[model samples]
Each structure stands twice: as structure tokens, then as C-alpha cells.
Target: MQPAPDRLSDRRFAAIAHFVEGSVGIKLPPSKRIMVEGRLRRRVRALGLSGLDDYAAHLFDRGALGAEAEHLVDCVTTNKTDFFREPAHFDFLRGTAVPRLVGQRTDRTLKVWSSASSIGAEAYTIAMVLQDMVAAGARFHFSVLGTDVSRPVLEQARAAVYAEAMVEPVPAAMRQRYLMPSRAAGDARVRIVPELRRLVQFHSLNLMDPSYPFDRDVDVIFCRNVLIYFDAPTQAAVVERLAGHLRPGGYLILGHSESMAGNGLPGLTSILPTIYRREA
Candidate 1:
């Protein structure tokens, strides 16, 4: 009367893959079927379904896709990121990009966008770096905006709480200055300090959208690691849309492993293998 609990019908897996790709630009191939099943298991259990078969039935047969889609997307897209992951990017921003922008501006303000910020680590890391620059007499004020498509991760980003071990990559002085250790004895958690938290904000944004609803003249945009999940066309389109947001002379930083070699980003020049500067 029922299909095997572990078997997600190939047809349903195809449907899920299509929806994921269409909704978020994340290409989930058949090779990722097992990953999809594994991530969806908890959702299936929560819905009191016996397995992926019942879950797919609930979605497609019972007309639950519209109601369940966001949660479905959230379950699969919670990517792992760390404070100061890929430290060299921040070093480049601090040493070269910031100074270049400062020289080009009469105002003392900077805008940084973490286009795929996950759980706020990347945004807060930027704040920590910028605050240190200010302390060292870099004359500028800065704001950081962290956006992601997943609501659950955006909620985590807003809360700004992290396990103690999550902050390990943060340098000692920054850890002491930008993080607030839990007052509860034996508790191992920290919150971004109020000062740093005030400098950052988070919102939900699906990169697949034709146009973003924020400032177009962003000074620095960190869109790392995320493009890998997309197919070449989606990656190029997303990069184009992001390039549209950069101010002239602004920088777009990609993950070390990601590149724009064949993307044909017009008006953008390669600063490094992974960094591009908009034409001034």
C-alpha cells in the first residue's frame, strides 16, 4: 500500500530540483538527490509523513507546494560560513579598496553589502575590520547590509548570537572588542557587541529576482561562495545584476574558489582572480 520510506520517487526529485533552481537559482542536479532527501527528512518527519514519497504527495498531490515551499527552500540552503573565512579578501578590502575609495570621496561614508550573507558572520566581520580601521585613523563611517534568501538564516543573522566555537577564527583583539560573551556561567555563546550590531542590518533577498530592492550604488559587494550553487547562466545573470548595483569604482569580491572568467561582466575589471572593480 505504500512505497519504500527511503525512496524519493525520481519524478518528485525532478520536481523538487526544478522548483529549487527556479526559485533561488540553485541548480540541484540528480546527483544531489540524496542530499535533497537527507535535508528534507526532518521536514518529512515534522509533517508526520512516512517518507519522501508521502512528503512529495503532500506537496504535489495535496496542493501543498505553495504553502510549504519557503520552508522547503530553507531546509536545503543553510550554508556554512565563518567570521573571517577567507581572510585575504578582508585584507584586500582594508589595505587597498578602502583607501582607494576614500581618496575618491569627499564624504566620509562607505556602504558594504554582503549579498549572500549567511547568519551574519560575513557582515559582522566587515564591521569589525572597518571599525578597526576607524580606530587606526581611517577617516570614514560605514554601514553593512547582509541579505540572504533563507528566512531562518536571516533570523539567525538578526539575532547575532553564535556558539563560542563559531568565533574562533576571529582574531584575539577583535574577539575581545566586537563580541560579548554570555554572562551565564558555563554557557558557550557570544553575541555581536552592540556597537558592531548597530552598524549591520539583515534582510531576505532571493538573488533570482529581476531587480534588487536596495541601493544601487553599493561601494563593496561580497557575493562569495553562493555563485557556485548556480549554473553558469544563473551565475552570470546574478553577477550582472550585482554589477548593476555597484557604484563606479566599487569592488565586487567573489569567493577564492569562484571566478568570472567567461561571465562577460561588462564595465568590470579584474583586480585579482576573484575581485572585480567597476569602471570609473
Candidate 2:
């Protein structure tokens, strides 16, 4: 009367793989099928479903597809990031990009976008760098915006609190200046200082969407480590959209392992490791 459990699981995995690949261009291999199952098992149990089959049917039938889809995408997407994860890029920004941009434009204000900013480390790192530059008499105005597709991570970013382990790599002096030591009610955790928190903003953004909402073009965009999850066509589309949001001579930073070599974005050139710049 009922389908076998393994058969149902296979069906569900197929459906999920299809949904994810279609929505975000992530190809989940058979090895990761168990990963998907493990992550969603709690959801299935919470919904009081018998197995993956029933859950998959419910997802399609009850219009719970959107939420379930988001959960799947969030689980598979890696968020391995830390403060100053790649120091050299920040160094380049400070020593080269910032000075050049400041020289080209007398106005001291600059806007930066962290396009796939997971839990805000990349964005906050940018803020710290900008603050240091300002302290060194650069006299530049800076605003950092971090965006991601996951609502849960975005909420965490807005909170600006990180576990003790996450802040360990942060320089002692920068930690003293940018973070406050405190213990959560039950857990001992250090949180970012209010001053640094005020410097960055977080929002939910879907890169695949056709439109972006920004009044002024951004001066720099850190879209690091995100393109690997996207297919070629999607990656090209995203690069084009990101390029459109940049001012002339603006910068686009990708993950160290990523390349836009064949993407055909004419005005952009690879200036540094995984960093591209727009023609002035």
C-alpha cells in the first residue's frame, strides 16, 4: 500500500537536488544526500512526518516549498569565515585601492558592499580597516553593507555577537578597540563593541534576483567565496549585475580560488588575487 522508505528517500533527495540546483546552482552529489537527510530530519520529525517521502509530498502539496527550500539551501551553503580571514586582501585595500580611489575623488566618502557576507566577518573586517585608515589621517568616510540570502545568518549578523573562538584570530589591539568583553547569561561570549556595530549594516539579498536596490553606485564589492556555489551562467549574470552597481574604477573582490577569466565582463580586469577592478 505504501512505497518503501528507501525508495521515498531517493525520491526526496532527487527532488531536493533538483530544487537546489535550479534555485542556487549548487550541485548536491550522492555523497551529500546523507547531509541533506541529516539536516532535514529534525524538520521532518518536528512536522510529525513518517519519512522523507511524506515530507517531500507535504513540501510540494502544502505550499511549504519556499521555507523548506530555504532551509535546504542554508544547510548546504558553507559559511566558513573569520575576522581578517585573508589579511592580504585587506592590506591591498588599505595600501593600494583606498589611496587610489581617494586620490581620484576628492570627496572622502566610500560605499562598500559585501555581496555574500555570511555572518558579517568580511564586512566587519572592512569596517575595521576603514577605521584604522581614518585614524591614520586618511579622512575618508566609509559605510559597509553585508547581505546574504539566509535570514537566520542575517539576524546573527545584525546582532554583531560572535563566539569567543571566532574572535581569537582578531588582533589584540583591534580587539581592544572594536570589541567589548562580556558573557552571555548562560554562555561566556564576547560581542563586538557598539562603535563597530554602528559602522556596518546587514540585509537579506538574493543575488539571483533580477533587480537590486541601491541609490548610488558602490565603490567596492567583496563577493568572495560565493561564486563557487553558482553555475557558470548564474555566475556570469551575478558578475554583470555586481559590475552594474559599481562606480567607474570601482573594485570587485571574489574568493581567492575563483576566477572571472572567461566571464566576458569587458570593463573589469583582474588586479589582484581574486580581485577585479572597473575601468575608469
Candidate 3:
């Protein structure tokens, strides 16, 4: 099959960028136009469309817009993740948050939300930390909810399989305990152990929604490495919504590079670097 020709023009770039920003709150700047074109070419070819222009038209045509917007979000959004990408967050969870939750709560049900859980690594990391806590005789019920804007990445997260390189950050003991060597694929890959997978759930979520559908209060929300893609206002708005989703006294964790310094999000007090607590 012949390759689909590049048809992303300045107008098409603007159109695609606008759709993604409006749909998912990811800001695609002018510098990302080339990256957008490159990433979207695969989608065009996969759909057997004539070119990017045709793909854009197909995306916008009538009833297909809603469904295709999901595909576009999957295409343009980046899903770069790995196990234990940030170690400090896990340390905080183990040393500070878990102890606090277990000591403070009577019911001992701990709920964590991985707000942008691309590929499930972050969610699984949270699970591992909780599992460790349980292993050390801290009696508490815990679960992780991993949500992302891209369905494809959510599917990958649900699968819970990873190549060796992706699992390299996982500690040796964790690799032996929480992951199993895969013989089915006959490759250097591993699957998250069944127990851990059971504790984590993945869902397709758009942060732009007026209200999130979480039924219960979340104890900790990890919206890391995602707000950087959005403009400051969008970041503030997302932070606000995440704050709302938290239980009073719950925590909100952001990427180290993201700053809410001047955002002045109400009801949130910065307790640590990149960590905020919702006021009771």
C-alpha cells in the first residue's frame, strides 16, 4: 500500500490543534505543528484516508466527529511513561501519606486517583506502594483508579504488560514479586502480577468535562506531567477540578515542572513541593 501523502497545512494544523485543546485541554503550540503532522500521518494511513486534509474532513463530518475525536486525541497526545518514573512521590506515599491515612481514618479504605495515568505505570506504582504497606502489616484497604484522555493508552494500561526497558525502573524485588515473566509472547516482557492488576482500574477520561464522575472521595490524586501540556489557565482549571474531586484533607500531586504558584486555586494549600492539600 502506498503511503498517505502529507496534507497537514497551516490551516489543518490550527484545526487539529484547536480540536484537541477544546476536547482534552492539551495545548498544541505552533512549535508542535510538525510533531502533530508526523504523529497524525499514521492515523491517516491506518484509516485508509487519502491524506491529512481528507482525514481532517472525515473527522469533522457530521456524526463521526464525536467518535473520531477520540482517535485524534489518541493520535496527537503523547503517552510517555514507565514504572516508578518519579521515585520521590512513591516515597512520600509510603512514608507520609499511607501512615497518615492509616493512622487518621477509622474505616481504613484508601482511594488513589492517577489523573493522567498513561500506560498504567503510575497507577501500578501506587498499588505497589500500598501492597508494600500491607506487607509490612499496615491493615488498610486500597485501590487505584487510573484515568487518561486517550483510550489506546488506557487499553495498554489495562493490559499491564511491559517490555524489559519499561520495567527497568521497577526495583529488583518488585520485579520478582509484582511482575511475572511472560512466555506467551516469547519476548523480554513482563505482566503485572494479578493481585496488583486487581487493585488498579483504568478508564477513558477527559479532564475538560464539567464535572468528573467519581462517586467516592479520592484520598490522593496524581495529575503529574500532564498540566505542562496545557496553558496556565487550563492548568489552574484542571487543578481546581482535581481539588474538588479530593476528599477534604486529601492530597493533590503535580509534576515537578508544573507550578501553581500564581494560580491561587482556592481551598488548596501547598504543603510540599508539587504537593497540595485540600482544606477541610
* Maximum-lDDT candidate: 1
Clashing pairs in 2: none
User: What TM-score would candidate 1 get against the native?
Assistant: 0.97
Question: TM-scores for all candidates?
Answer: 0.97, 0.91, 0.93
Candidate 1, residue 3: lDDT: 43
Per residue, candidate 2 scores C-alpha lDDT tens digits across 85-165 of: 778889888988899888887787899999888888889989999998998798789899999988889888888888878
- Residue-pair clash count for candidate 1: 0
- List the candidate 2 regions with Cα displacement exceeding 4 Å: 1-8, 183-186, 261-263
Candidate 3: residue 190 Cα off by (Å): 0.5
* Highest TM-score against the true fold, candidate: 1
Better of 1 and 2 by TM-score: 1
lDDT of 2: 0.81
